[model samples]
Target: MSEIAVVAISIAKPGCEEQLRVALEGIVAPSRAERGALQYDLHRDLREPRRFVFYERWESEDALAAHGQSAHIGAYRKQIADWIEHSEIRVLKKIM
Candidate 1:
């Protein structure tokens, strides 16, 4: 199997956790339907409601790149920016 992934770490503005959750839920379906999306999951910190993460897997680098420009993903980023404090995004390739 191809092994490519993306990890997104986001900190929501104070009191914006629920809003962020709603926004993230809205994008799930579209992300799953994308051409090479193998998996996409959203996670929240158990101890910190304001912290969130997205774990995504794709078939290849090209597929992941395509996701970066996808309409749903773009919309999510734009809409959530106002509710977010900061974000760190990284892409990875499996070695083991």
Candidate 2:
């Protein structure tokens, strides 16, 4: 089966960029270590410093689901819930 990809975008609330960055950064290493993780990367928009994006690839839908249920992810979500102004997540499957 083809890999599953995820794109998550987050916009931080004013005055919360650094804290949001730290919380987002903290998830990378552990996510990369997950069994089905193919890629897990984070990016900050240069023109919009408070904007953050996550690019991730997982082995399967189940793997992606597991990631959503992960302890670290749960904690990260809870930690940033109040600090973010907006968030979006997309899950995709490659066509070619």
Candidate 3:
């Protein structure tokens, strides 16, 4: 099966960019170490510092699901619950 791609966008509350960035940064290494993690990347919008984006590729849908239930991810979510203003996640299937 082909890999699954995930695009997650997070927006920090006004004035909480640094706090959000720190929290988001904490997830990258651990997430990359997961069993089925293929690629994990975080990006900051040049025009909007408070906006953060995650691009991830996983071995399968099940793997992606496991990533969501990962202990580190759970912890990260709880840790940043109040630091973020909005978040969106999209799962994609490659076409080419």
Best by TM-score: 3
Query: Regarding TM-score, does 1 or 3 come out ahead?
Result: 3
lDDT digits (tens) for residues 32-87 of candidate 1: 99999999998989998899899999999889888889999898988998899989
lDDT of 2 by residue, 3-94 (tens): 89999999999999999999999999999999899999999999999999999999998888888899999999989999999999999999
Tell me the TM-score of model 1: 0.92
Overall lDDT per candidate, in order of appearance? 0.90, 0.95, 0.94
TM-score to native of every candidate shown: 0.92, 0.96, 0.97
Query: Best candidate per lDDT, number?
Result: 2
lDDT for 70 in candidate 3 is: 96
lDDT of 3: 0.94
lDDT per residue, candidate 3, 28-71, as tens digits?
99999998999999999999888999999999999999999999
List residue ranges in candidate 1 displaced over 4 A. none
Kindly report which residue pairs in candidate 1 clash with one another: none
Worst 10 residues of 3 by lDDT: 15-24
The clash numbers for all candidates, in the given order, read 0, 0, 0
- Report the poorest 10 consecutive residues by lDDT, candidate 2: 1-10
Clashing pairs in 3: none
State in Å the error of residue 60, model 1: 0.9
